[model samples]
Target chain A: MEKFKKNERVVALIKILSDNPNQVITLNRFSELLNAAKSTISEDISAARKIIECLALGEIETIPGALGGVKYKPILTLEQSLEFLKRLCTELKDPSRIIPGSFIYMSDVLGNADQVATIGRIFASCFKEKNADYIVTIETKGITPAIMTARAMNIPLVIARTGNRVTEGTTISVNYVSGSKKIQTMSVSKRSIKEGSKVILIDDFMKAGSTIKGLKDLMSEFKAEVVGTGVIMSTAEPDHKVIDDYVSLLILNDVDETSKTISIIPGIK
Target chain B: MEKFKKNERVVALIKILSDNPNQVITLNRFSELLNAAKSTISEDISAARKIIECLALGEIETIPGALGGVKYKPILTLEQSLEFLKRLCTELKDPSRIIPGSFIYMSDVLGNADQVATIGRIFASCFKEKNADYIVTIETKGITPAIMTARAMNIPLVIARTGNRVTEGTTISVNYVSGSKKIQTMSVSKRSIKEGSKVILIDDFMKAGSTIKGLKDLMSEFKAEVVGTGVIMSTAEPDHKVIDDYVSLLILNDVDETSKTISIIPGIK
Candidate 1:
């Protein structure tokens, strides 16, 4: 095996930990992989942690038990989170984003991979302690951020289908009222989630929280617990939603189709 | 700005470059961000690249000239790709995954974030040279891998809806035959993809190639060229498909419903 210097070990450590966020990596494995000593690996981790903290590049946690070693937590600082949301608000406030039906043309924002991953990291930071077993979202627009959140949190992403598809095999479904007041059905594979598992419900946008409520109802069928709920954006109207106690990154306060202007602000202060 | 040691600098460089894959980061930007001299940052990058190559993490390319800079490409070497695929095949071979309709229950596999990211990295390695402007896929299953692939390539992900949703503004719809011989409609927002841009179509499964064909048709309406098509898995019985040029990670050779057995092998030699 080839010997690695401290710089090389640090690089390898950061890459491996970043790739598998929130998952523990034993020191012995790193020692074997890098052909380094445990003490050297420990020192390397301290150096990596310092740079990560100094640069605000998430958190590197060390678990001190026999089963513990090190793990990367995608926790963004409060300042970083606010800065990102503020920037997102500006991008979303562009006049040209307004469509005929007062809808914001956000396909470009939601479709950008790097941007979505950043949003995912923010969410992961927000609900890091919920200890979620899975991140759940309905199909279509929500999958992008939900999958990213799952990736950041190092968890499985369970996407409920708009309707039960044959490919999913034995799904439990629930009907929910959509933003347009139309009744819609969503379903999840029966085996996708386990009973009594803790889950986080993540959505791209929330209007009345009906979709979140419906997802909650579906989770009940599987006997799973909804530990956290997060939405990238939520409408400000209707003051009271069907379900409260959810974190939203941005608030869509108003949209003027005639003036071609949109008023969006950061949510949750 | 706090000065960083060589080990710390390597850690920060790996974190930043790993976070933004396939995207260029100039030495000046690194110098400003890390509070290091340009020449020092260059050496740090060299150290990072050496360890990355040593561990088969990916490639770090240094582009030359005025617009040149360092970029991280998520290209898994041949050995790594085969190892991942073979392990996936072994996992998929478990008889418990067989559904009543002979459909394999792949929700768990598709929903795994870290594993899916690995698959995305493999796809990125497969299509890295295509220089696609965007990664495109149809709704639901394909979105996970597609978004991950887009993240790996540092590009945008464009998803075509199964049906025209009111949320998406002015979509272009196309009707095509599904694998089960049902005519289905898929649509993409008119402004979602740029006209005359190059795109890569990604799908989770290809059966009879109708879904992939439909997505290609939808891409054509926008005057976008389909530079490459990739599927995680493709069935072998058809022996013929609407499209001939594509890459598949795995081949589903057979599924015996009675025996609850599935035979899947790595595709593309």
Candidate 2:
């Protein structure tokens, strides 16, 4: 703790931001961290923000809320993030990667750069609003964005692991049916979250609501609140909760595997 | 394209690095970029390195090679990275995450902040070698590390998708078993990468060789070479590959579903 003086203020600010979870903070709140006057804290913050911004790190936004303050956009610019995703897509786009159904496989995209960067930035940005204390994602696809967002917000990222990891802690498993006409069970740990914390649910693709519902069932044990839900991409297939209020990077309306025709639509930027 | 100065020397230097992944770079090769006097280029490099180091962003390591040039440790310090990983694990270790047989799932650790920061530092360190052309990862779990790693390396991050999307020009899919015992297919598109790219692969977990093998197959199609492979965690499963060189944060030995005992081990620093 003693060695933290030089970086204390920044560290303190980071902790405050983390504790707020999906909420934005104004200059006034940051000023209260120290005995220094609001102006002095503001000056320090401006200098700190410059360093972070120049690095293409996080962002700072001013919200006109009733208790308006400068909110940190834990997310980065879309341009900055797209480059990372483009790279991943590029590699996966290789002719060698061609498969039978004309379906472009993307296990790597779920785990690669641009997709990861965009996921991180978006999650961070979404949580910049208050009331989001934790990030939740269905096993497999949803974990990527959930991780990125949780980390940016400096909060814990909880995963509803697809099934059971026999060697870990306690688990909460829920069974659900997929559109593919298969029933599956997803599980999560009982120790990875806090009671009453607001949770944001995320998924990679939402063809149905079963998986999201499974996550909701799991959260029930913790008595947590579902603050928001998001998806990276979505299809036109209906029958899901429609995600109370959601954000998506792209929308794939139709995929004709035979014609090799695919439609890609950018989400609300 | 016109914006990049045609520094044949710098280009050549980078190429040399790409060919030799994870190796240190000396000043002599840097001088070769400009065909300038060794002493002159040395000074320029020193200035350049100063700017880089001053940013507290990337590492510009200096090693005294046999040829008496500098060898940079482009990777992050083990201590810094370990600390961050521990913090992530601790946070992910929330008590509210307890599920019966499930664990505090960490599929998303790939893109979370502490992990991303640590991963960024680590990959940035690798880029200091000046050879990594691209960062690679299989879909889903690999995206987070690949994104942070690519960001740190300031290179493009490539992902292997699972299915083909029409938006992608051309794609190749390979069938392989993911860690979960599911024989799933992975995909990548054509024209995403050129031949002979030096790539660093990062993944969230490595329980089986299938996904990596699928990625390797995809890479082979593009004539791209795998320079390094990284993971956040690896399980000591009999089915796991032992010969492949990888960097991981933690190692899981056995997950006893009945006893609720999970044996954990730390990876090499």
Candidate 3:
């Protein structure tokens, strides 16, 4: 019998396992395939586990029953995704977040990596079931997470600009009121969206839900349906309108600069 | 000799290896520590690798050299970061992006998970070197990436809200021009930024750099030093009064809504 080399044995085992996702491949059968001793097979199995773990491509599980074997899981949990966003909100909510009128400063958290991962995951999970054809958001801050989410789902994203421009093609503009009682028009070009598409509305924050409302109105011209909405953080204040079935990772209750105190609550749905 | 349980042995290996990030660990040393046969130690190492990869913590390396040993590189590469962002940006450059004259809709991307990951890695790589004391951005879209970036760097993020609210704290406002004609007053609370601190500016776009300049002026009152600036996307048409060290993941070139052709260039910064 040819003695099995460790590398060769491990590679052979993975090939066999690839044929069976979420199924346990028995150790005994694996040993026979590699024609190696039980201990040698065990070593090879362990090596294979390491390789898979490092890649994050899949998972390995060991079954304890009589016919048990190793299986793999390739999904991320909802809590794990939200935890990343919460961490970002927590760190960003430091005393320095204290700005006049109880408003906190938070641009830094949006630009960081770990936090971005959290935001992307949370939004992805919300839209995963929708099979959204496209992702849409207002320009500027909304672009980061929108782009991140679109890439993850392998969908295209459309950005709505605030003003009209000649270079953008045809135009459609809608008027909306701001929190400051100012009315402004937000626009999306004619050629930007396809007719009869499903869209997921995304924003950094939802104060009055006016901007999202404007976006929804803009989507109407394209005959697009807004499947869902997502936000990283939101104020729990009652005066604001809420987008149905929307998700936010953090809820800001109060932010004070002089006293340097911020009240934050974990967000759900 | 009594043998260590496979799970315990695997966990121990992971602990040791993780503690020595980006460094090589010899197989002999591993065997000695686990007090197991060389074959057993090898098996344990492989098992541990599988778990790490699945968790998305990092990676493992095997060097085929006389002096080479198994090494785990905990760091993720820049190319991987950029690739993720590029994929994200491509999907986001949809014709649906054009709003009114030429604005692109992107709130969805900003709120999604994959986009968050791309934004996180980009900023993490950019500020991976800078010991950023704080992350700063104005309200709205800028907040998403700012929070994510700060979380990746494990730093605090501060946000400056628009308008004056007395309940928050004392604040200062700066006048900046937007749309080249209108004078807009953007405010930052006095206590938001610390004195003589290093801050990285984060924003969603840089059409005119006035928003950034307004933030810079606000930071001046606190005597905060502006370290750098970063954006998820930029037009690159030189709309800004002055441009400094900045980064963008995508560039919107032309949005022909009528023709349904929106031109884009992947971010160079």
Candidate 4:
């Protein structure tokens, strides 16, 4: 095998680390793949790490021990985060997005790949310290962001379905009242979650926080715990929420039907 | 502004291109970001591109024109694809995965981040030439693979819900027979897909191809054309399928309930 140059090695290392975020890659693997010595691989990693940190692209943590190596964790600077959110607020201000019942239409934004990935990285960074075993979300809109977060954190994604399906085999179901004050049933495959696991809950939008609370209740059925909760947007109404501890990226303040005006602000961290 | 070293520039270039696959990045933009001359930036991109191709990580296409600079596209070698499918077949061989009615319980595999991403890349490569405007899939199991493909293709994902929700605004619903020979209603938001657009349908599993057909029927309602369809697995029992043209990675041939045995193989391209 031919040895790779410093530039080529750096490029490959960045791609490998970025693709498998939060997962350790030993120096031996790099040395073997690039056909280089351990010392050369170490220098290459250091150079890549400095570039990542210097640009505030993300972080590379070096673990010290026999079972340790290096792992990448994606991060965005405060300025970058605020800039992205502000742009999101502006895009969401379109009155055409106002649907009936004061609901904002954000399917386009939530479905866009670039936007969803950026949001996922931001949410994953926030919950990285929680040591979550899984990232959980309800079916439909929340799956995209939840999947991205799961990829970023190198964890499994457990989706709570609205009902059971034949493909899911036996399932455990839970009932909770939705924001509309209607009782809804949410179910998950019996084998999806293991007992005593810590999970982070993510969703596209939050209103009365009923769905999130329902997830918490559902997690209890498996003896699992909800370590953290994150949402892209939450409404300002309902004064009091079903759950108090959660993080939201945007807050929907008011939507004026008469003038076709919408108001949005960044959510409190 | 400080100039970036070639090693740092190469790392950043790979990260940016990998993050935004299938999107073009102009030389001027890189020069501005790195605070270097266009010639220097061009050299960095060439180095990065060579490294990517040498490692079979992906491809960087440099279009020569006023509008084009470079675009990244992810690809997997045939050997890599076959190896991945072989491993997947082994994982699915466990008799415990066989549920009642000979259906396989694959929620665990579908929800897994790493496996889903690999499947997504394979599917995306298969359908990349279609230039799909949106990736469409039904709710629940298919969302993960669809989202990954959407991310890879740099497009939006439009999910068809099992039922309508207030959050989705007005929806167009269609009824079709599922593999269980039961009539099911699937709906998508009215604004999710634009008229005259091309879409690709993706799903986790197929039996009788009823769900894919349903998605096709649903897409026609919006005047959107279904250019391609892909799935992770399909059963071989259904010799005659609802959709004749589609790609599946794995084929489940037989499952003996009495002896607790299962048979699986790679699907024909």
Whole-structure CA lDDT of model 3: 0.66
Docking class of 3: incorrect
* Model 3 agreement with the true structure over A1-269: per-residue lDDT tens digits: 55544554554466445323335678788767667777777777677677555533345677877897775443245665556556665786678666555656554445444345446556766667796888888865566666556644556667777676453556788887755667888787565577999999877777767777888888887899988888777788855574566777678787666668788877863
- Please compute DockQ, using alpha carbons, for every candidate against the native two-chain complex: 0.84, 0.16, 0.15, 0.80
Predicted complex 1: DockQ: 0.84
Q: What does the lDDT read for residue B204 in candidate 2?
A: 70
lDDT by residue (tens digit), candidate 4, A1-269: 87888989999999999878889999888888899998998999899998898878899999878877899998776677778999999999999988988788998887887898899888887888898999999977898999888888889998898867777888999999977888999999888898999999999989889999999999999999899999999989976998988999999899887889999998843
Who wins the DockQ comparison? 1
Off by over 4 Å in 1: none
Candidate 2 ranges beyond 4 A from true positions: A1-42, A47-71, A75-112, A236-244, A253-269, B1-56, B59-112, B123-130, B133-143, B154-196, B203-223, B232-241, B244-269
Q: Residue by residue across B1-269, what tens digits does model 2's lDDT show? A: 11222222222232233222234666666555445667665654454344334433234445665666643333556565666666665655554433454443554454355556566566565445547787777655556566666655646666676665554556677787765788777776565666888877777777765677778777877788877777767777754483386666677676565555555565656
User: Distance from true position, residue B190, model 1, in Å?
Assistant: 0.9
Task: List the candidate 4 regions with Cα displacement exceeding 4 Å.
Answer: none
Taken over the whole model, the C-alpha lDDT of each candidate is: 0.90, 0.59, 0.66, 0.88
Prediction 3 TM-score vs. true: 0.54
Better of 1 and 3 by TM-score: 1
Q: Which tens-of-lDDT digit does each residue in B93-175 have in candidate 1?
A: 99988888888888888899888898889888888888899999988899899889999998899989888887788899999
Q: Which candidate tops lDDT?
A: 1
Please give, for residues B13-113, the per-residue lDDT of candidate 4 as tens digits: 89888888888999998888888898998898889989999998988989778887898987776677788999989989999988887788888887788
Residue B80's C-alpha lDDT in candidate 4?
76
TM-score for predicted model 2 compared with the true structure? 0.59
